[model samples]
Target: MIWQLDLILCLFIIICAIAAINVKDLLGAVIILGAYSFFMCLLWTEMGAVDVAFTEASVGAGVGTVLFIAAVSKTKRRSKD
Candidate 1:
């Protein structure tokens, strides 16, 4: 049962990673990367690493995402294409 949950999380993480890389829009890719970080945090928590998970959640999904968004906003470049 726990393994099943882990498998599901891994699948979603993989999908998010692929989407983040494939996305042409910088903002969209950043958002997807945030989602990937969130899922990774979840996986870490599930694996009994609560401390690491919290760090990943706060830094990866929180401040990191905010910083990325701020940078993108300042640049105002929509997409490469």
Candidate 2:
């Protein structure tokens, strides 16, 4: 595996993680979390875990994001606190 690719993917994952956590908007944070999952899927694929990568792509980046978005759309975007 190319170390540079792994490093870049890791950096992306970290950035997504931080961005998701720090974002004030619930929808934006969910989108960032989905991006983080995609990066994680890529990293797993690069490390020779195609099965895990596929699962992550389908579940983590796919259904999970959709579910979160659906839930978010059903409610208010911000909290009263």
Provide the overall lDDT of each model, using Cα atoms, as 2-decimal numbers: 0.93, 0.93
Stretches of candidate 1 off by over 4 Å are none
Q: What tens digits encode model 1's per-residue C-alpha lDDT throughout 1-81?
A: 289989999999999999998888999999999999999999998999999999999988999999999999899746764
TM-score of each: 0.91, 0.93
| Model 1 residue 38 lDDT score | 98
For candidate 2, write residues 1-81 as lDDT tens digits: 899999999999999999988888889899999999999999999999999999999988999999999999999777432
Candidate closest to the true structure, highest TM-score: 2
Error (Å) of candidate 1 at residue 36 is 0.6
Task: Report model 2's TM-score to 2 decimal places.
Answer: 0.93
